[model samples]
Target: MVDGESEAADIVEHYELDYDESGRITRGYQQLELVRTREIVGRHLPPGPLQVLDVGGGTGAHARWLAEAGHQVLLVDLVPRHVQAARALAEEGLSVRAELGDARQLDIADESFDAVLLLGPLYHLTDRGDRVRALREAGRVAKPGCLVFAAAISRFASLFDGLARGFLFDPAFRSIVERDLAEGQHRNPDRHPGWFTTAYLHHPDELMSEAAEARLRTVEIVGVEGLCAWLPQLAEQWEDPERREVILESIRAVESEACLRALSPHLLLIARRPG
Candidate 1:
């Protein structure tokens, strides 16, 4: 592993990401993110057989589906456990390859892939320069004019989550929420390590600016779940197909509505490197 990759691995190992991300999209509010991301990504993928680089694609969650759709996928991640899990998915015949690597310094040649997905790296990188380095690498490996899908936790997510869980009132938890609102940085204290590790959430404008800094043209920065992503009650909608469909449609309908973008727990940015 490269230096950056090693540093990332050491930091992320504390989170036990493989276990947390397991079946991530199959249940709860996370499903909202998965469904919307799939819709946006599938809509922009180039026609015919395509090559995709899934940088920081933990445990092959998205890569498996891309390969199942007949696209060729190579998934790289900082965590070794995630790499192992991803390789297991590949062994099961998903047309994918998995390996340990850093997104800031990809091992591929320039313009090598038809598309790239930096789904989980940006938030973890924390520093602006580190995040920009990862984005530039993704842009470098992507074929000119092709899609690059990037995902980030929304800047206001912690506040919304605290509100939904009814924990923002406690003095200790209130400090954490205040820090997240005041600065996009998120750090869980020793008492609340399960809340999250070191992370940098992004405002939608910051995401757009980062894409621009990487020499990528912004296609759109979509709200992954629109206005209700943090509501604790929405998890119940998953049990009823009709309620689920309505909830799904509700989020999708406001994906580009601007006013509701910041309310989502996550945001998906569709961008392209200049041709």
Candidate 2:
């Protein structure tokens, strides 16, 4: 757990620490697992060969898919279980590699890859500075013009979750809520000792600001199943390919609509590092 970051200990304890059937790859994280594998990969890669790094993308969902698509993928995560599981999966003929690490730091050299996928770190880092640090780490390893897609939760959604879950008034939780409201950005994801994990609710502008702070340029801000995260049965309702496409289109349809995009539950921003 990082000292300056909140929820580090709580989150680490809550995660499957060793990847023994925690179900994120197949259970609760199911929605994001698919949304990311499909939408995220396409957003970063060109038709030809490209190098990609999946930062905190557990289970190698995006990495494995991209590898099979003939691209080079390196899956990096702090959780050892996630990395081991991803590596085991990669062994079955996917051009994917897994490494255990913190999202705010990379073992590789600077400008080592074409694109970086930061789908998990943004939602978990409590401090804005920590978030910036993670973004900077990504930028450090990616080449100029490199594509980077990062995920963030909507601000209102955080309060909704807190109040709805009865943690809105807790002392630790209140601190984060007040911070985000004041900053017009990220709220707290602080958690109790265990039983659950901390997750931030965010704003599009806050994410954009962080990207700019890290010297990254925004390209596309894609919302992956934002409205549907609360709608448990929606993804299951997509019975056929046509219906699935329709559902996905509807979710993506409001991608740029200001009024709609702001409140979307989850936001995936396609950003680039300037040369």
> Measured by TM-score, how close is model 1 to the native structure?
0.93
| Segments in model 2 whose C-alpha atoms lie over 4 Å from true places | 5-7, 17-29, 158-196, 232-236
Per-prediction tally of clashes? 0, 3
Q: In terms of TM-score, how similar is model 2 to the real structure?
A: 0.81
RMSD of each: 2.6, 4.0
Worst 10 residues of 1 by lDDT: 1-10
What Cα-based lDDT does every candidate model obtain?
0.83, 0.71
Residue-wise C-alpha lDDT for candidate 2, range 84-186, written one tens digit per residue: 8889866698888899888877798999988898988887786788888899899989998788878887776655556645667777766766765665344
Cα lDDT of candidate 2 equals 0.71
lDDT of 1 by residue, 132-211 (tens): 88999999999888889999999998888888777787777778878888888887755363366667889899999999
The per-residue C-alpha lDDT of model 2 at residue 214 equals: 88
